[model samples]
Target: MVRLMPRKGERGNALLVLYSALIYLFLYLPIAVIILFAFDAKPIPGLPLNGLTTSWFAEALRDEKLVGSLLTSLRLAVISAALSTALALPAAMVLAWLPIRFKSLVMSMVLGPVVLPQLVLGLGLVILLRAAPDMVGEPAIILAHTTITSSYATLILYSRFLGFRRSYIEAAMNLGASEFTVFREIVLPLIRPALISVFMLAFTDAFGEFVVAWFVAGFTETLPITIWTSLRQVISPKVYALSSVIIIVTLLLSLVSQLWVIRQTRLTSKAPSA
Candidate 1:
């Protein structure tokens, strides 16, 4: 019996698929390992698979310090993400559409936090906060996270606005719509998906940030700080359990944000009927 040989194009496609699969596996295998160990009955995480158990998750939830820190992180991340998005919106609009001198300098300044080392940024913020001791706890952490996350928010919105149709705004103006009305009715609706995506990304970044938060945290504890403290002593399986929860939540948020963007793109791509 004669066997059919695959064409060169088929071999190339197969290789490309295999290459992509390997890359994804490399990136995600460590995360999978952590999730697996979180459910493993083995007290110390390692090879030789132990029976699966959910006790670690319960223990993590029951730990007052861990739970409290998780809540604090949630609160901080929400406030920071909101504040960052709020600040970034106007800045991105200006950068994307407005004609201003020294625009490059302004952009660089806005993005400084993202490029600067977190340790140095933390130190700088610590020094700045010295005068105001009252803001050394949650307030300080929120401010620091906002400063860092705003840069990313700005970048995302700026890119979105760069491709935005200015004709919409001009048409609104011709129809006697005020700038505020135009923004609220026109720009806001178009960019809502981008805004939501930026907020989700900022929230995830702030939630996981530890270095700057550690510097300005003072007596305040976040989940990352708590995990770091736990790591100093004997590591607990509960830490892994908590981490798995965070990873799962982050993945969900990311997936939702991506889907939102994709859906919006599809909806926008269809031309309006005559």
Candidate 2:
């Protein structure tokens, strides 16, 4: 009896190829559908490639309500992203700097919304706001978005902070730097990739959110809400077109941010050597 050591290299290559195909299919399948349906002249989605036309896109461009909703979505996303990042930066700092006893409890509390259904969170927020002075609008939407997205920001930033070389901050302090100054100068610059990643995640979550937005937003519609409303009335191909635009934009921004993070990490990894 003889035992042969497997050509571990071949197994690795096979696994890589399989994973690559799976990832590509997962990512591109929906995008392909969105693109195809976007150009489809027929309002109803089907096979046999209906005559290609730009009417859906043209209609999306001409739709003023859609435009308004998109603007609202953008504004909410930007505000939510900024507020979440601001809150997370400090919260993450605490989580990193202090050895908290209830770490799991704290992390779970922060990630409650992510684990819980958005519909449930929305319903709770709506009920809470009902007794107060009219609290449903852009403000309410932004507030709800911030609550959900801040947790993500905190997670991302905390990961970076936990992995960061604390000696840099310590060195800064040893060099007679103020605590705030050290954080601003050394800590911030080092963890910038995490900060940016969190900001983008917050923005994306806020922008794509439908449940929370629908529940909190009063009369002031966001893009997802608009799509929902339209979906009920008519399954407009323009909806697909609008979605395509959003998808493309999101993909572009995500790629850019990922590249930036990669570059920053590479720089950080090489800094000690330099």
Candidate 3:
């Protein structure tokens, strides 16, 4: 048997592979640990597995506070996503297609929340909500979340509209279609994927938001606030279990969103020639 020496390019490729693997491991090892400890029979999450069990998951689901907070989060996320996307759709279209005076000023206001720190945004909302103390809980949370999510939603939809083929709209107008008719028949169908992507992204952002929600949540708790509260007391393995579920769901959502967007892009690209 003959031993072969690795070439210079082969050595570089091997190092690159090793480097990429290390990066991935660094990023994902903690998530893997959390997932593993979620199932560990140990009452507390830590190293050295005691035994494998699924009781934590059951316990997490059974915890009223956790379940309630999760439900609250879901409700807020859905409402925020829908409201933000609906608000963003028209704003995005106007920004992308129409020429208006003070465009820069208008855009700066629209995008202000995105660049502002969540801490500051929350504090500002707290001040604003002082006038109407009635809106300090779930309602306030929904408002704040929508405020943040709408900026992102607008950006996404604006980008989509910018890349849109104006020919379609023009063709509709040439055929004497009203603006509403054109939007209902032409633009909406074309941008359905983008709208869905914006909604999902907004939902995920609002669902995971902590600082803003914490400030406005008052007595009502969202999932992140609940998790933070739990951390201050005796940490529960159920938290880990719930977290693992969230992580898995988020990963699935992200993967699905990416694939859907890519497929839509490919279809849109082929539509013109077809």
Candidate 4:
């Protein structure tokens, strides 16, 4: 019997699958190495797998400096994400639903930080804050993170608002509801999932951020900055353990936020037809 050759479509699909596998391996190989090395018993994170052990995690947990830096990172991430969301929501609503002149220019300004290099933004912030040296610690880092993350929050919220049905607002208005009342009753609930997703995304970005934080942190050491400093001295097993924990936490947070965003999008799409 003659073996039938693969069709062209099947050949293309096989190539696509191979390409995808390669891409995933490229992206996750380092992460896999980090997780594997986190269990290495050796002080140095190197080959030969110095016998599997969990002591490095305990060492990382007990390191007072690492613990303090993790706490600082958490605080900064929460404050910055909340502030970014708070500032972006109203601006996004206005930009999406209201007619305004130079709207493209306004959006460009809001998104400028994303296009600009972090090193440049950090240096600029440092120069700007030099006038008031007192604001160089946690406040400066939070402000810098908020500036960067707010653009992302605004873009997400704007997309949600743009797709929003104006009929809801109009209906509430016809019933003698105030604008604030309409927003509180009709808008907030519908957009709550998007809001939460944006907040989580911002938190994830800020939590892992390092460059801008390094420049503006002054004496304050966030987890990323702490890790950077430690790496310069030595690639400790503790660092690997900490990185593994962070990787798990960040992946979980990002996955949940992305899933929530997708679910909210599906709900919104179905609502219009229903």
Candidate 5:
């Protein structure tokens, strides 16, 4: 028996795989540690696991403040994600398919939040909300999250819209379908998966967000804010348990969105030639 030497391309591929594995290890090792420590019997999170126990999760679940914050975070994420997706859809369609003036300028404005630092954006929002002091808590947080997440949603939707088949719209119109009818029956159905993907992405981002939410929350306490405040003093194992749960949820959402995007892309590629 003999082993064959790898070709240059094979060698390059192996190196790429190794590099990707290292990157993933670096990213997920800490998360793995946190999840492991969440179940540790020890009060403090560290190496050399002291017995395994699910008590931390139960403790976390029993905390009224943590439960309330989780609920608030979920509510905020849902509202912001829905609002961002709704606002982005029409804007993305127009920007991707229509011949509008100052298209670049409009796009720049839409994507401005992505480029702006979160701290700067939060400060700006805080200053702007000074006029409406009543809007400080949940309102301000929702608005800020929507603004930031909408940029991402718009970018995702814009790409999806750009790849859309105009022939479908034209054929529907030729059959005497109104523009709105065409959009409702054809465009929406075709891009539904992309919409879901964008919505999920927005929700996950808003759920995990901290800086902007911190600045605008005022008296509101979302999950991230609660976690931050907890970290200011002694860290609790319950917080670790909560964080592990959040990490799992976020990963699941992201995985679903990515799979949806991949499926949508495949379907798009399989569309019949015009």
Candidate 6:
């Protein structure tokens, strides 16, 4: 019995390690290939990864369509993030402090997109907006992005607001501070990081979102949609270059969020109690 128990324990540990490695490999193996192929000198993906080349990266940068697509994507992201933040701030503030009984219901409505499939949402929007052709441009893109990102913005900012010290406002009021003054001096600074985080999220998602933007802006192609077009019928190594750029930028953003920007959101060392 003792010998059997020892053998079982050893097998369990071995299985655990093997499973862990397999999971990681499954997750990263494709990404590793993408990175590897991005640098390959060959025009084709699989053949002769002999030497690395800077030419692909240069072509990616210089491609007029790619450049235009990048600019359009940036514009879409900026507009989306800005609109989302603008709409979410007041909504979140009310949600945090208002004495509404159906708070859960309201929250579900706000956070609906988190569960909803992006494709379904996109297709639905397309059907609904099919009657209105005039709304396809920056305005349509902005509205779609706002709808998609507002919930995220609200949730993030509201979570921060939950831990906020209301007494600071009370104390200021007791000392005859104006409502406007208290909000400006206290509330805004405290929620700044939350706003920034939401903005970043909104922009990132908007820039990469293929389906919704494609549907919402029928004639107007944001960068992702354009990139898809470039990829499909007219595939090229330039796509690899663009993919490489996207991967690098995304990785950098993730690093910044994890290491610098989010860490700057110091919750523990908050303002002193009232």
Candidates' C-alpha lDDT? 0.92, 0.88, 0.92, 0.92, 0.91, 0.81
- Weakest lDDT window of 10 consecutive positions for candidate 4: 265-274
- Listed per candidate, the RMSD to the true structure in angstroms reads 2.2, 3.4, 2.4, 1.6, 1.9, 3.2
Among these predicted structures, which one has the highest lDDT? 3
Model 1: lDDT to the true structure: 0.92
Cα error, residue 152 of model 1, in Å, equals 1.7
Candidate 6 per-residue lDDT over residues 157-181, each given as its tens digit: 8887787778878888999989899
TM-scores for all predictions? 0.92, 0.89, 0.92, 0.95, 0.93, 0.86
lDDT of 5 by residue, 1-274 (tens): 5769988999999999999999999999999998999998989877798799999999999999999999999999999999999999998988998899999898889889999999999999989999999999999999999999999899999998898889998999999999899989988988988899888889888988999999989999999899899889878999999889888988887787788778886887798866
| Model 4: lDDT of residue 143 | 97
Better of 2 and 3 by lDDT: 3
- Model 1 clash tally? 0
Candidate 3 Cα outliers beyond 4 Å, as residue runs: 1-19
For model 2 the local lDDT of residue 266 reads 92
Candidate 2 lDDT tens digits, 12-100: 99999999999999989988898888888787866777699887888988999888889889988999999999999989889987999
Residue pairs with clashing backbones, model 1 = none
Sequence-dependent TM-score of model 1? 0.92
Better model by TM-score: candidate 3 vs candidate 5? 5
Candidate 1 lDDT, 1-274, residue by residue in tens: 6759988999999999999999999999999988998988988877777689999999999999999999999999999999999999999999999998998898889889999999999999999998998999999999999999999899999999998888888988999999899999988988888999999889989999999999999999999999899889977999999999989988987897799888987786563522
The true-structure Cα RMSD of candidate 5 reads 1.9
In lDDT terms, how accurate is model 5? 0.91
Writing each residue's lDDT as its tens digit, candidate 3 over 1-274 gives: 5759988999999999999999999999999988998998988777777689999999999999999999999999999999999999999999999998999899899999999999999999999999999999999999999999999899889999998889888888998999999999989988999998999999999999999999988999999999999889978999999999999998998898899888987887788631
Which candidate ranks first by TM-score, i.e. highest? 4
- The segments of candidate 2 whose C-alpha lies over 4 angstroms from its true place after superposition are 1-23, 43-45
